[model samples]
Structures are given as structure tokens and as C-alpha cells.
Target: MGFLTDTTHMHIFTWVVGIVLFLVAASMANGTKGKKITHMILRLFYVLIIITGAALFFKHMTIDSMLYGIKFVLGILTIGFMEMVLVRGNKGKNTGLMWILFIIALLATMFIGFKLPMGFNFFA
Candidate 1:
């Protein structure tokens, strides 16, 4: 119960879960034998990420509200780009733009996350 209120723990938990699920969804999206279930699972993971992320955001927001807001927008864009890539890939359509967007969103998200106060320091 205490961990539920611990923003650091919550952030780590959600990050790992979201990343693992994102990888799984990406793999499934690119597979020739894909299933609708993969989309459903991805959607579930996205919802989980949002919920946990909201908790983390509300609990740990700093005086630099603009930076936090940027991180927050990047987080949502990350999810949106992910879904775009999945959709376009599943349809066997050109996904270059989607891939580019996803990569940019991911890098931005990670960069901002690491720079934020109380955020994860992968080097440490």
C-alpha cells in the first residue's frame, strides 16, 4: 500500500510494464500471423501506463510546471505514436512517418524523464 503512494516505485513499475508490453505489441504488430488480441492487450497496457503515469505526475510535479507539462505531453504522444505505428504496420501500409514519429516521441520521453527531478537516472 505504501508503495502505491511512492512515486519512484510507481514510475519504475509502470515504465517496465509499459516497455515490456510495448515490445510485445510491436513484435506482434510486425508478425505475419498477428491477432486482434495483440491490439487489445496493447490498448490495456496503454491504459495502465496512463493511469500510473497520472498518479506519478500528480504526486511528483515540481515548480517547473512547464517542464512537467512537456513531459506529460511527450508521454501521451509516445502512446499515440505507438498506436499509429501498430495500426499502419498491421494494415501493411507505409509506416515510415509513424516509425519516425514513434522514435522521436520515445527519445524525447526518455530524455525528459531522465532529466526530471526525482526521475530515473539510468547511469546511477
Candidate 2:
């Protein structure tokens, strides 16, 4: 449980993992032939993402701040919504509301993730 010493490695890994999760989840939503398999993989991928995130947070526990706390809560909501959609088993319902929330959360995550100047620097 060490901080990623090489920022590049962390960035690359995160990108790869995120894209894979997105692809799998999207494919499942699109009614892929192996929808069940894709769903399972997506679930596992999400679990890993959360676990790794928690580990990183623990590593930097002293960095606790309102921004990080908010992000954590958002992440939890994202995962909860994802689970709900997966279990609902109705394409139309899943695509309508949950997917929209998922996309919004994803975009928000990206925005905060890069520390983009979105009118504030919460990490500061």
C-alpha cells in the first residue's frame, strides 16, 4: 500500500482501467450477446476501483478535506446507482435515468480528477 511513485504509471493504469470499465458497462447496456458476463466484469471492475481508491485515500489520510469527502460521497452514489441499474434488468429504465446520472458522475469525476480550473481548487 504505497503511493504510486511514478505519476505516469498511475495515470496510465487509471486510464486503462476506466476505459475498460466503461466499455464493458456500455456493452452490457447495449444488450451485448454476453451481457451477463459483461455485467459481472463491470461489477468486479467497479469493486476494484473503489478498493484501490480507498487504499489511496488511506495512504494520504492526513489530506482529508471537504472536497475529498464530497468526492468520496459522489463515488459511493455512483456505485450505488450502478448497482441499482444492473439489478433493475429493464433496458429502458436503466438507460433513461441511471445512465444519465452515470455519465454526469463520470464527467464530474474527470473534471475534479484533473484538477481543472473549474472556478475552484478544492484540493487546496
Candidate that would win on lDDT: 1
lDDT against the true structure, per candidate, is 0.76, 0.57
- Tens-place lDDT digits, model 2, residues 11-91: 336545755665566556446657767677767767766766565444443554555555556666767666666666534
In Å, residue 99's CA in model 2 sits off its true spot by 1.6
Candidate 2 at 30: error in angstroms?
Answer: 7.4
Give the lDDT of residue 25 in candidate 2: 62
Which lDDT tens digits does candidate 1 get at residues 5-124?
475666657667776766677776355554467677768878877877777777777775667778888999998988887788777898789888888988998888887776777756
User: TM-score of each candidate?
Assistant: 0.80, 0.66
Candidate maximizing TM-score: 1
lDDT of 2 at 113: 50
